[model samples]
Target chain A: MFSPLIDELINALRILPGVGPKSAQRMALHLLERDKPGAAKLASSLQQAIEHVGRCKLCRTLTEQDICATCTNPQRDSRLLCVVETPADVLAIEQAGNYSGRYFVLLGHLSPIDGIGPEDIGIDVLLERLQNEHIEELILATNPTIEGEATAHYLAEQAKRLEVRVSRIAHGVPLGGELEYIDGGTLAHAFNSRQGL
Target chain B: MFSPLIDELINALRILPGVGPKSAQRMALHLLERDKPGAAKLASSLQQAIEHVGRCKLCRTLTEQDICATCTNPQRDSRLLCVVETPADVLAIEQAGNYSGRYFVLLGHLSPIDGIGPEDIGIDVLLERLQNEHIEELILATNPTIEGEATAHYLAEQAKRLEVRVSRIAHGVPLGGELEYIDGGTLAHAFNSRQGL
Candidate 1:
């Protein structure tokens, strides 16, 4: 609203998820008034990231190099592969500090209504990787939403055809979750998947 | 966390007001995965804004040129000058579509504990402008906080010395503000400032 450059900056900032017009304006003014140097650094960093970062050839996760850190790390178990919807999911799993397997990021789930199918989510590429790699177990770690479930089921069929053991990540009450607040679907899943303790 | 470039980008993004580590990570991943082109545009726009936008010489609001649009607009009431704390305040006032006077930005309010004083807020520059301009009335539109009140009182003294009429923006119940939820200070002000029907 102040100048063309500022207007452009505000519009560009709207690309960020959850940032609306008012928030974008606040961010733009904040950068201009308080942190010009930081804004410049952010600009350069954005350009560098956009130019350098791309999908890892093997896992489809974002990386500056041909392969991502997890994909190339020798310490991770190559015998087990985790399939996830996006790079964010990979970060979440890694942050938990429990999973130590290689990952294959689908980037999106299969949604036939939206015209996103197996080829759309790079299923062929995943199938090719499974065939070439020594991965004996495939863990479907996609979200528990309907699209994620459909994608997992389809991938499981492909893994079975290739004679690879496939497992879906458990759907149950979260560790800190209260049963009273847990959704019906999750509670049902927790009950159905009950194991002797 | 993924790579050096990604890490740098995330750090740079954290410069935005109110964005924490998790939000920065989410924004970075979203740009990388969903909107690379938009991210590039934002980068370029940020650089452009940093290089071009600066404080308007007259009004102290953000501008690409020597003078801001508000300062240059002949249609505005130049005889009535409004003093504010920041460019964001100017934007907020303009958005209200009621005020038509010129503006002088202090950029900050008086905070003695923080070592902020008249010079720090460009009080001398404002005084000089008042001396040279034909402004007959000075409106103290600073915020209602303690610091804002101190700044406004100080500026009022200066305006009185300059032989210009000084007025503080009224603090009353905001439009559509419910009395039941309004703070005691604001309710008292509203009652004190009650006008004829």
Candidate 2:
């Protein structure tokens, strides 16, 4: 076993996604032995972000200020709001640079078995925005997983009740994907959802 | 793009091994969204370990004190020293639980192309130990790479000059390894080094 503090560092690093005990150990040793300056900077940055960054009051994406940059930007189309499941999803959409709209981060999707509901994912906050804002469309951009589909369906019902246009992001074989190599389920879904020319 | 602080955190986290842009974003979001307390603890633990931990004087392994625990342990065999390339190697040997000898970490191996030689890896410090201490046997436990082999050969010559016995870690097929699956180089070594038993 390593010294207590080194062991603690390794254990703490294990909490990161995809990091097991061996990777954590390697990370700790690499930091301590090879990259002390980088490690120090990482620690300070983590502390600062954790201490200051909170949910944007409007979109619920993480930010140091009340509203996130994307939500507050005048260039983005406020009337065409895209709702996503996490801040990372917001980033993904932003990086694509195709969407010129604001966002509403659910922070999670409905998972009844795990006891997470609409309330748990801040649906009430989203509803309040829908009630007040002149949003022309409510885009459902959640994942293609079962829970994500359920979430999109639930949100579509809500958007219909409010008479707002609602659409799910396209799901099929990925761009550049070979049809022959595509999974059966995805291929079937693509065939079923074949678009009119 | 994320807020300044969150973006900084993601960028800082990318310095870790195997963490690319996507993984960094995922980690930053995961910590902020699902595990704020865990993130805080990790930050504090990182800061504390970096601030407190330093290389042990005797063996050059990471420790808060001057001498590492293994070098100070009374139960370990001081007369039989195992030399390794890094602190991780020390842990690997310790986990095997069969070696009772103390360790001396080289932190690196000889690489003339990289301008790293005996002095750079603290071979001079190792020489001091070999000269001052009554170590009867020195075991070369460095990695089996070319640089590691060069380092082991260099250390072997030094130990021989000091009238100390030296041996390299065994090479060839691993325990429980199927002969058919073993590589040609390892199979050849195993055949050449076959014992009387």
DockQ of each: 0.86, 0.85
Cα lDDT listed for each candidate? 0.93, 0.91
Cα misplacement distance, residue A59 of candidate 1 (Å): 0.6
Every model: Cα RMSD to truth: 1.3, 1.5
Q: Highest TM-score, which number?
A: 1
lDDT of 2 at A91: 80
Candidate 2 C-alpha lDDT tens digits along B1-197: 78899889999999899999989988988898888888988998899999999999989999988798998999999999999999999999999999998989999999999999889999999989999999999999999888999899999999999988999999989999999999998899899998996
Fnat per model, in the order given?
A: 0.87, 0.82
Question: What clash pairs does model 1 have?
Answer: none
**Can you give the TM-score per candidate against the true fold?**
0.97, 0.96
Model 1: how far is A34 from its true place, Å?
0.7
